[model samples]
Target: MSERTYHHGDLRRAVLTAALDVIRTDGPSALSLRDLARRAGVSHAAPAHHFKDRSGLLTAIATEGYDLLAATLADAPDLRERGVHYVRFAVGHPAHFQVMFQPDLYRPDDPELLAAKARATEELRAGVADRTPAEDAGLMGIAAWSIAHGFATLLLSHNLDRPVGDRDAEEVFRALTGVTFRTQPAGSRVGDDTMQE
Candidate 1:
């Protein structure tokens, strides 16, 4: 069968989507602009019209990832659920997750990237707004991010396969979040009431 043709307006998205697939299967180090163009069935320079270079394409992918994460967080009911979804997204979309946080590899300052990052941060903060105190908001946000990010990192690095029930990542995340909140210091910004048993 012949390769499908992407219309002009959608070629950029198609290229990015194909690039993500490449990264997911082959790792970041294996990504190449020419390869992505080939996979997308477009001219080698087609991606340049939308993304000036490899960094530009990577930045666009990261921006798209952030936007997706922000939407997932927004759909969650509470901070805990939001955190769970965040971790889930990371594990489920390893390629996007890998690129989104690597500032050195992508141009974080790119307009699309900056906006998406800001929106995602806002979404997380909004999820915690009602449940956490003003002073604790920042800490709570960072803590939630850390919990998910750390868990994802651990799982990705294969360090989470210990005898603790050979716990699945989601279970480990929930357990860690529970334990951390329960053992928080008295003066800790996050109150015990916010934690689920």
Candidate 2:
């Protein structure tokens, strides 16, 4: 797809997708507007016009990530299910997941960024509404998000560094989450004895 073939919205979307592809393959530090333009088959200036600078592009990506995460978590039936969805989203979109948490990489005060973040937080909170007292919702949200985020981070970094016998990483993760949330373990306790390096 050449620049001429791209309309307004299409061009922006194409550029973003190209950036995502670059991040997925080479990591975010390897991204550049010029490289994204090359990948999108657009002029180098095209991405600059839309995103202004690296921070602007990252802000857009981060906001889009939050929106996507919010949508995915919304489909879950409860807090635990939402936690699963959160990890799945992070594992699937490691590019976005990496960028979304690095506030210094983008305009954290940007209205779009703030709104998207709020929506994602609200969705996460709703999942645990009945389980948490109203006054403690914020802390519970933080704890829940932390657990999911930590698990996803470990998974992505290959830091589990352990053998899981016959179980896959996802199965072990579900078991760990079950223990954290005080739910019945999907199989047995996912301790060092059950799955260790």
How well is each residue in 98-137 modelled by candidate 1, as lDDT tens digits? Answer: 8888888888788878899999999889887879999998
> What's each prediction's TM-score?
0.81, 0.85
lDDT of 1 at 155: 72
Best by TM-score: 2
| RMSD in order of candidates | 6.0, 3.8
Worst 10 residues of 2 by lDDT: 188-197
Supply candidate 2's per-residue lDDT for 25: 80
